[model samples]
Target chain A: MTDLPRPSAPPVSAPTPGGSNLDVLKHQFQQIWQVLAALALIYMVFFVLSEPFRSFDTLLSIFGQAAILAILACGTTVVLISGGLDLSVGSIFAVVGVIVGIVLAEYRLPVPVAVLIGLAAGALMGALNGTIQVLTKVPAFIVTLGGLTAYKGIAEILASGRDLSRFPENFQVLGSGYLVPMGIMFGVALLTGLFLTKTRLGNHAFAIGGNEEVARLSGVNVRKSRIYYYMIGGVLAATAAILEVSKLNFAMPARGQSYELFAIAAVVIGGTSLFGGRGGVGKTLIGMLIMQTIIVGLSYLGVGTSVQRIAIGIIIILAVYWDVWRRPAR
Target chain B: MTQADTATPLLRARGITKHYGAVVALDAVDLDLHAGEVLGVVGDNGAGKSTLIKALTGAISKTAGTVEMDGKDIQITTPTEAKAAGIETVYQDLALVNELSITKNMYLGREIVRDTLFGHLFGTLDFAKMDTEIRALFQKLDIRITDIYREAEAFSGGQRQAVALAKTVMFGKRIAILDEPTAALGVRESKMAMDLVRSLKDHGLSVIMITHNMQHVMNYCDRVMVLRLGRLAAVRDVADVDGDTLVGLITGAAEDKVA
Candidate 1:
């Protein structure tokens, strides 16, 4: 770029005050291609490792299993972009499952009514987390850490340490039916993408995450925006729980344990920044698929569950490392 | 009628004072921002220039003051109210989010939306409209960008300042307050930024620029206000004084030249 505007240079000449258009295209492609390439590599390896993985049924089943985690990761993407974490999602997930199971089995409510109650319960838990974080001026990490333990305790008490199971066959459609959970995941993802890109609240979340002080000066209600993202995180956790419980035909107090870690791993692998601001649910979906593929691929290769976990842990670390290393030139 | 009654100032402040516990940041500062004029605020460190800007922008509360717009008293308790009241500030920090695209940063707090079938179900951004609007705005300012979709971090310091000015023009139609618009630029880039500031005036927007650059004040500002030790030392039309006189007033070494 020329330091000084030449006397002869047309006032609004050709390209950028920064770099050439080609340079921008190259930078843009680098971010998109890295994840695409990784996904392709994972698929290539898995295709060779197992014949069943190539089957259409297995592909659908993989997505079906990924549905719950992918939905949870969508919420995580929102929170992370808004510069917060939701460690309480797993505990919230467990509690939602327990609440839904009780409403359906004990209260004998209709599935729709029970589902709404469960979602509301999840929203309440999220509101609690957000309210405390905002009002008390506490960090989200600390607030949600407390929530992780406290919510699990609530789930345990609700279930009285006994697993709840055996819902109506109609209720099973939500979980056992491949289309429903997958449909929910896709619907949630689509909505999330729009929210992040189009809405004023979505823009506020990015502003808050990017620089809270700046956002405040720009007339963004930073505190309210933060609370909203947390609420969304809560509601999504509940949705994931509802699906998981329906699929298993059981709701245990311990269900969704360490599920927070899995969701976070998917978000990071999808290249969302842990430091907050700068990512989307689209990349997060890719991240979720990559995570699931690894787990499934390892199992097909006869690897033990423990080894598969170790592999996942390593990938998460590497993914984060690569993100930090490969963050576009500031 | 008083001499000042012939034409009402666009905005007026009287007896504005602010104290931070023990320290008095601003002391009975009175000023007028007239329509279609550049008012340059010059001061040394802690001269209460920033404090005064914060007060005017409603970023903070004043200990005692009255602000009048069109002869009507108004209370601006927050930045949002300040914005709604047609006041915009381009802070020294520029206040751009590095992670967001130029378009996103431009419309950070205020986003435009359109109703679509899915939008009725879940709201969507009217990105096409925003893109066209921003592109036209940049073209008007003579700022070239390879891609508006590029993040703010990808731009140079000069380019970012241009983008910030575009945002100010978009939001602050009545008045623009720039806190050091040319502080860190090279000579040519400073010229570019100054030209953008000049364009704001040409478009008939009132400007209040705070800077240490005497040349900039002399060249760009229509009137200059000097603050010293939390007090208004001098306010003069740029045509009446030289750069040295302005500096002397800022340092409290020269007698009040204007009065």
Candidate 2:
């Protein structure tokens, strides 16, 4: 609970100098460590809920699946940080799957060629969303809602209402391959986290979502930041789709149905405020793992599909409810 | 005690006029602010004070006017352009992001980068360095606070004012316009803000303060400029006027200065 906040503040210690200050810093680190350690302890207690499915392989599988959601959530974390919502991301993921499938299976394109097309299409879609939102000065929610429908429709049209199957051997290997895609997901998450905490654009993203008008007055390029952030989201969502087809060896326009909810739920559960500003990719990774663990563990326990679905809804409601602590004093 | 009175004023707006749709917001306004001086702007609500400040900050474009920096006339159509030209404005809201730490809020849009254009990651905000620099800046101005890393929401109003001013100076601003720094603040906080204003003059930064408070004009500012409706009322040295005479000027009945 306490570890939810990163070091947004300077290290606080009495100015006691050269060697002793190291001791003071050590002491501060101890406090943060304790808080994080406490959160880990709480997570273990929940394993009682997932006890029946507790196995080495089960845990590894949970982590692998969590890795994908974590990467997607990291991207959403950036958008939320910049004060945007990409509802069309779900549809974009489905469209990417269909595109990658068709190119490799029907057109017999190279894997890299299909990937480039998939990534380009995603970024282009996200740019359109950002452009419309900025030009109309409307809320991103409205623009992306329209995008949600249009993008999904585009995915369906590409599939012609049929499932895509029989990808080339290399394509199948990339999707369900044990190490590569899983490794890619983790690497993306780590890179995204580093980018959020380190880069200039990351700083601008936080500032834009924090108080956009103030940021504009302070010389932060709001529009440029917006476009970059949405583009990042586009790439992440589309990558998730490519990985999905790579694993499953098939794709349909419905491949990404409801995935937007999972990504959003992960970010929201991770403590990223939908109000924009604050929160980072690291916390979102934790949120994603937590969600994946809950869902995957429940499935391993042979929980009914309907029950699992209801629990996901309940879990999201519960997560948002905890934000009562974050509200400003009345 | 200071060289600002005769120093080439950092910015001067002459014969400025702006209108929105049909209503004139600023009318033929002329004002100048110099290093080592606090030029206090006073008027009632809707008296063109805010509109003039927006124009000065380049939040609004001048329909017909010229803004000068070091005697060179120029055009600024945006706040970013104003900043590039070394003019900064701290609005009444203070504009600090409440959720971010003080240094994070201070460098909100102007982070200090290291070897790469990409600044530090989370751990790289250079807590020790930013803390040291901010501490020295505050100490030089004789302001003290417990936490420089706490959220701005936790700071006292006076401390936040100091932070806002520090942010402006840190951005290398040559001219700063403060919109009612003391308006909703308590007496002690108000005094703190005024002391910071005094320190800006001491550091050779020009400041233009907008306020309706007469005591601020008498105690701190070198020159008092009055705005009546959408026009220039007058600009005078504090030595040449009293509170009653200044109020009369705002009301438009005072004909001439009684020597």
The candidate maximizing TM-score is 1
Candidate 1 lDDT over residue span B22-140, tens digit each: 99999999988888889999999999998998988888889989999877998988999888988888887746877788888888777766767865555467777888899888888
Model 1: residue A5 alpha-carbon error in angstroms: 17
Please report the candidate that would top lDDT against the real structure.
1
**Clash counts for the predictions, in order:** 1, 7
Write candidate 2's Cα lDDT for A233-327 as tens digits.
Answer: 98998888888888888888887777777899878776777778777675676677677666776676677778877877886787677655655
Worst lDDT run of 10 residues, candidate 2 chain A, spans: A1-10
Interface RMSD of each: 7.0, 9.4
**TM-score of chain A, model number 1:** 0.90
Give all candidates' CA lDDT scores: 0.85, 0.75
Q: What interface root-mean-square deviation (Å) does model 1 yield?
A: 7.0
